[model samples]
Target: IHSDRGSHYRWPGWLDRINGSGLIRSMSRKGCSSDNAACEGFFGRVKNEMYYGRNWAGTSLEDFMCFLDRYIRWYNEKRIKISLGAMSPVKYREHLGVTT
Candidate 1:
């Protein structure tokens, strides 16, 4: 998993968990945001498209969670990404013969 060099990520407990899971840890280089640009871009798009101009003052936690879940599904299954041949992530995976 790629993450910033946060203190929580560097804790012994977190390190143990990651090691036990066999997941490689990738940290961005010091003072460099380019290494995590893709992740940043995704957050920016999500906020701009789904979060901006929204009022969540009275929304329950469950309702917000549901909205986030639906948006994520739509992003993966319906939204086309220009970098992926104008195909949604689900379609791109299918095109690559990846069965999920």
Candidate 2:
């Protein structure tokens, strides 16, 4: 998992969980904004498209997870990007004859 060198990530509980899950921790160098820009941009788009201005109060955690999963699927498979000539990521990949 990629993250900044934050104190929270260094906490014993967090380290234990990462070790238990067998996830490799990849921390960016200090003051390296470029290392996180892509993920930050993606997260910004996700918040703007599905999270902002939504009344998520009273929603169950399971329901929230389901909604997020569905939205991500749609974003990858249905939402078109002008930069990709108005094709979704999945369609663009297919057009390029790329297989996942």
Candidate 3:
């Protein structure tokens, strides 16, 4: 997993958990949001295409939560990702037969 050096991400025990998992840990260089541009872009698209467009304009928090849940499910299950060769995240993972 990659993260900026924010305090939440840079907690002392964070490295221990990552190292314990045998997966490599990586960080973006300070002040370089471009290093994490893919994630930033994904969130930008989510907000622009779904979230911000209807943000908090509903009847109640329950309704808003329902909208967010549905949007997230659709985003993961149907929205095509440019980086994933236009496949949804779920489709990409299932094609690879990954358990996680």
Number of the top-ranking candidate, with lDDT as the measure: 2
Q: How high is the lDDT of residue 54 in model 3?
A: 58
Residue-level lDDT of model 1, residues 30-85, one tens digit each, is 99999889889888988999889899899999999999889988987889889999
Per-residue error at 2 for model 2, in Å? 1.0
Candidate 1: stretches off by over 4 Å: 1-27
lDDT of each: 0.90, 0.91, 0.79
Candidate 2 yields a Cα-based lDDT of 0.91
Q: Rank the candidates by TM-score, best first.
A: 2, 1, 3
Q: Pick the candidate with the highest TM-score.
A: 2
lDDT: the better of candidates 2 and 3: 2
Q: What is the lDDT of residue 38 in candidate 3?
A: 84
* Residue lDDT tens for model 2, 10-99: 899999999999998999898888989989998999999899989999999999999999998998788989999999888899999995
lDDT of 2 at 53: 88
Which lDDT value does model 2 have at 35? 83
Tens digits of per-residue lDDT for model 3, 37-88: 9898877887898767454754697887787789878987888889998888
